[model samples]
Target: MATGNKEIVRRALEDSWQDPGVFDELISSDYVGYDPALPEPIRGPQGAKDNFKQYSDAFEGAHITVKDQIAEGDAVATRWEGRGRHTGELMGIPPTGMEIVVEGLNLTRLRDGNIIEEWSNWDTLGMLQQIGAIPSATAAQTR
Candidate 1:
């Protein structure tokens, strides 16, 4: 069951960035996402697909790697790292063509072999700094 859960997440992340339709197979109709970037209770599979599209649209060639995963009692946790080039607008910030790397962890809960809920924590500040939306601390110190 744990392996199945991991595979579901792996495919979901890869496919969401490449082919969003995969969500129809992996996400539960009653799915909900707890993410800081989105409003509470992000509605079902379509919501998940849309969220991924937002990131992928901002970062062309965005790729996510699952560095580690652990599952027990219907809950799976994944540590992930991702990189991409800022080729489109992000949070209204214009494309900077900067390469960005970000790391995060996601905890997903599965019910009846499909993802029902997820909570994610990621390095949004770091990505913003890399894209010049926010000044880096080092840059401020040097100024």
Candidate 2:
């Protein structure tokens, strides 16, 4: 990764959750997230912080460890792992105090030393299924 991109990732990951300043340093004022879960992309650094707070509240201390980073031009692809214990509501589901180890990738597009846009792919269904928050097939397929 380029020095600036790595710096951005470091601030966003290694510090963001613990320190809000990370957002100030690495996120754009007009940021956008292409997450299907959100109807529209977050429009700024504060918006990004807002989204993180909601999810972070659900899984306190949850964090991502980048397994690999592929940087190409203005984009960076990161493969990471997230580990946390359910301690608050998430997606209308109450906490079960279960621990989740989820792995996924996040691809970000940066410009002017800040994240302008992002796309993420993660195991949502698998995670809910693992935590018993959603039903999974057992014994045989349902009709």
Candidate 3:
């Protein structure tokens, strides 16, 4: 069960970006996702699709790599790294054409082989710095 649950989460992270349809298969209708970068909680599989779309729209050829995963009972925690070229506007920051790397962790809860809930925490500030939307700490200190 643990291994299966981990695979479910792995697929969600690795496959969802490329194929939105994966959400319909792996996410429950009642699925809810919490992410620090989001202004509100994402509800249902459609919400997940929309959330991923936002990033995909902003980053061309975006890909998420699952770095580690641990499962216990009905819960799976996954650590991942995402990389892409900033080819479009994101969070109001225009395209910089810079390649960016961001790491995050997602804690997913599954029921009957489908994800029912998830919580994500990622390096939003670091990403902004990499894109020049916000200055890095070193730059701020030097100024």
Candidate 4:
């Protein structure tokens, strides 16, 4: 069960970025997601699809790579890296055409092979800086 749970999370992290439909299969109906980057918690499979859409719409050719995964009982932890070129609007900021790479970790709880809940922490500030939505530390200090 532990190994299978890890595989489930690995697929979710890698596949869901490009194909939000994957959430329909991997995320449970009661699924909820917590991310500091989000203004509100993500609820249900559709919420997951919308969350991924926000990023996919902003970053063209976006891809996620699962670096590592660990599972114990019904909980899975995954480390992942995402890469893309900012070719579309994001959070009202027009595209900067910058290539960005961001790393994050996700802790997921599964029930009956579907994701029940997940908590994610990622390099949101770094991504913002890369796309010029936020100034970099060096730029801020030099100003």
In order, what lDDT does every prediction score? Answer: 0.88, 0.79, 0.94, 0.93
| Lowest lDDT 10-residue stretch of candidate 4 | 12-21
lDDT, candidate 3, at 93: 88
User: Mind giving the per-residue lDDT tens digits that candidate 1 earns over 70-134?
Assistant: 99889999999989999998778999999999999999999988999999899988999999998
Off by over 4 Å in 2: 137-143
Model 4 score (lDDT): 0.93
Q: Mind giving the per-residue lDDT tens digits that candidate 4 earns over 18-90?
A: 5778899999999999999998999999998988888999999999999988889999999999999999999
Write candidate 2's Cα lDDT for 1-143 as tens digits.
47668667656765776787788789888888777667887778888888888778998678877788878888888887888888999888898888898877788889988988888788887678767786767612663
* Residue 132 lDDT (model 3): 94
Per-residue lDDT for 69 in model 3? Answer: 94
Over 4 Å off in model 3, which ranges?
none
Between candidates 1 and 4, which one is better according to lDDT? 4
Give candidate 4 regions above 4 Å deviation. none
